[model samples]
Target chain A: MRKLSRSSGDVGKKITETIEAVSEAIEDTLVVSRKFARQDEETLGNAERIIDSVLRRFSRAASGLTESEELLRTENNAINYEISDVFVALQFQDRVSQILALVCDDLNKLEQHLNELKSQQADEGSSRSVNVEQWLEELSKTYTMEEQLTAHDGTKAEIKTDQPGITFF
Target chain B: MAKTILFVEDSASVRQVMNSTLTREGYDVILACDGQDALTRLDGSKIYLIISDVNMPNMDGLTFVKSAKQMPAYKSTPIIMLTTETQEVKMNEGKAADVKAWIVKPFQPAQLLAADSQLIQA
Candidate 1:
């Protein structure tokens, strides 16, 4: 029982990491939403996709984490809720960093793409609708650029970037 | 071959450390996170010893031991209760369940190994 009790602690830590990943994904989505609003529509669209991707990852991660936590509860037979919390916090840092990096990378790309499009067409547009149209065009251009990014490397970037952008308030 | 030991614990970090430690000590360690699950795992395995914790959710350690002792297979298997608290009443309750030993928590791995050998040998 002593040895098994110790093993249950390990399962609890894995559940902790899983929960942290879910939380990180949620935070990242918020960041993506905010960042998309400040940029042109093209940038916003890309940001939206990134947000969606993060949301999906969060869902999957949350489910896996929940199941694992349940598994731990089922296996340990004993309740030591207080000690479990400390271990979860300790394990969360790693998962948080990984989710944050993915979010950060997607957000950064959207910002860069939007900046490039704005610089190219900034002076040519006067009406907000024209700017909107320009943003849409830039979004298409970014799609191509993103594709090129994937083509250059064999790695498949599964981050989704297809949602409508929130306009800056 | 070292005797097979089954450990049922709820905490994750503790489980990893024990799995590694017990596995290294030449004992085949099977882990269950809860008492109900432990009972399931016990079905076909040759478990010579049982190490479990008290105050767990789903099924507490004392309850688990009492149920296991009723099983013909585990009736005589040496059982140890691990706990952070050394309450006399709890120890007596465990004795009623046929537990062979009680080790206070914050146990050294070496001490546990020694206890296992001594109790199993006896």
Candidate 2:
């Protein structure tokens, strides 16, 4: 009967050891599961931050493009305005041509008058002087512009006002 | 129907520019190199307006105006003198010729267009 009690005590000790080992295994499994869950959360957070950074960069690029487009539009408008001014300025060619033509006509008349004077001198064999005052008056009558008069008088040309000369009769 | 305008000028460049400007505003333009050339185009056709230059090679603008006024077809046609002349004497001559308006060069396109609008109905 004493032998039987000793065996039963030994079986009880073995059962306690088995229960302790099972408890340790369960604790290890729970730590490993917690570590894996924390890694997954970190990876998800990093992915979200990277996505947010890329989106912000895309937004900034779009804003820059819009600004550049507006600047180009303003520049284009300014260029168009300048071109129109150039066209207006080019109209001076017509005035210059007219003035030059008048000068040419006067020169032709002077040549003809000189030729006539030479013929008269050859025929009369005497120098009949040209009427300087009459010639000058005739020359003055051909002038059409205030600038031309001022040029003939050796005076400074008058500054033209911004008001255009438009007369309605 | 688009109104026909007779544009007479000695300068080729001025004629080209004026032609472009007038045609852009939807007016039919008949170009002439000088006053004498302009008279040839006056062949009894309907002319809405006549724009002429004063100093031209064959015939001058004032003479052209006087001749045009004598024509039975274009006697009452409106005339405008476009020239570099700014003297009162020339202006008086133009007035005597029954010129409707006088515009000095270098003229602004906008000013010319404005004057055109005043004289011509849309």
Candidate 3:
């Protein structure tokens, strides 16, 4: 199992290349230090081929790392777009909350209006000066926003629940 | 240079989420809980844009836009009203107040960003 990190993509190539380069440098230094040692051309040639093969593999591994980084970035962008969409959708909570709050506001106003009606009747010693239509008109004043007005509009027209934008004039 | 956006919303949770999204995109965000609070926030800073909610405790969105336009510094600033109200009368009032954009609630980020990019300069 490989744990992916921001820099992990470069780790494999760097580690392999660094180890190979150091080993070659150390071997060449050893050869140079042994001044009186017998020169083995065949052994040295074999060592060169082996190092070349390792270096080629390291290069391929590095290329693979670049490919992996590209893939990871593509996937990340896709998830981010989805997350962005989700965040956008989540704003419905605010919309619904606003509507409910207005509904509650209407209810509170209605209750107050009813209480005033009862008080007027009680003060008059009978139900005489209580005009329900006038109270209804006053109730409409409590409703300010369009949604509240729409709810009060008695008609067959369906209320537009979707939020529409007006960008141009 | 990062642009500063004033977001006037009553819902704290919505503000937090929107703040995260806008700030992640390198925009400096100033928050206001209502229209009155939003009024206090407009202290002569060079605000790039404003995103406001319609229904609030102290003052509603249309009134806020009108009040914001009264401030000489923010009269022509790009204002986007974000709310659930979809009435033509209210929108007309907003237009009169120099609000160029009106975004409905539950709006997409791309929609908002597009409006912002179109309105806000570099």
Candidate 4:
């Protein structure tokens, strides 16, 4: 099949459109995620702290009251169940944080894709014409382009490839 | 001294390029990664304008604008949303959030810098 080429200008506009859409989606996710982070970050951590406080308070109160040993043991057992409940809540919090991380990762990918589009536009602008489908196909074959760095502890050190592969959609 | 402009973007590379270019143009440059972080750094700092990326981790640009607008100190601040997309809905959302301008990404550096100067001088 003959490859159809797009002018640098046209490709620039198309890439801009795609990047804007992805950026907006990321913004939407960011809105929700920020709210979650603000409201939820210390939620589980605070719950655990509160549980400890409650147990301490119960122990102090039981010591003051002239209750039977069995009664005090029953109160302790109830508090243990409550502590278990707090653990369950903490697990939920952890899961929610994980989901937010996934959202952040997707948004980061979108941002990177936008950067690639711009770079491609610049490269095309420099060259005057580019095949969009071929470019995208090549991008699809590669994984994500993440932030990376390489440095040797000493001079004349051999270079090694430590770059992660892109996970294309 | 040139008017100061603050840029809040998450990407390290973008931040570096923007800082270098903006500083070269005689503008005082301050940088932050996200909306909340920007707010933290804004105290005692005189910023004539703000340019922000839409999708950030701790705080998005629009929501940032919404919160910033509510602050009496920054009520008149001219906030611009920089993005790679040009969706109408997103623009409208930004408008409602009181963002002063929306710039689609891959912008020409000349045009972006020119716009910044204009906004700062105005």
Evaluated with lDDT, which candidate comes out highest? 2
What's the lDDT for residue B56 in model 3? 84
Against the hidden true structure, what lDDT does model 2 obtain?
A: 0.83
Best model per DockQ: 2
lDDT on C-alpha atoms for all candidate structures: 0.68, 0.83, 0.78, 0.66
CA lDDT, candidate 1, residue B10: 72
Q: Write the per-residue lDDT of candidate 3 for residues B28-102, one digit (tens) a residue.
A: 999999999999999999999998988888898778888888889998788898866666677787788788788
**Candidate 3, A38: how far from true, in Å?**
12
Model 2 per-residue lDDT tens digits across residues A1-169 = 8999999999899999898999889899889989999999999999999999999999999999999999999997786566446545665655656668778887898888889989999999888767878877787787777777887767977536364668999
Write down the worst ten-residue block by lDDT for model 4 chain A.
A144-153
Model 2 chain B lowest lDDT segment of ten: B104-113
Write the residue-wise lDDT of candidate 1 on B1-122 in tens digits: 77899988776666676677678778889998889888888786568889887756799888888888888889998988766433466778888788888865445555567777777787
Q: TM-score winner among the candidates?
A: 3
lDDT of 1 by residue, A19-133 (tens): 9999999999989987876677778788899999999999999999999999998775443333344333433332234345545665686687777667767776642223555
Which 10-residue window of candidate 1 chain A scores lowest in summed lDDT?
A: A160-169
Cα lDDT of model 4 by residue, A63-138, tens digit: 7675677788999778756644543344333333434565576567667776777888897875333455664455
Tens digits of per-residue lDDT for model 2, B24-85: 88999999998899999999999989999898889999899999999999988889998778
For model 1, report the TM-score of its A chain: 0.23
Candidate 2 off by > 4 Å: A1-91, A105-134, A158-161
Q: Which ten residues in a row have the lowest lDDT in candidate 3 chain A?
A: A155-164
Task: Provide the DockQ value for model 3.
Answer: 0.41
TM-score of each: 0.42, 0.64, 0.68, 0.42
Ranking by DockQ: 2, 3, 4, 1
Q: What is the interface RMSD of each candidate, in Å?
A: 23.8, 2.0, 3.0, 18.3
Task: At residue A134, give the lDDT of candidate 1.
Answer: 58
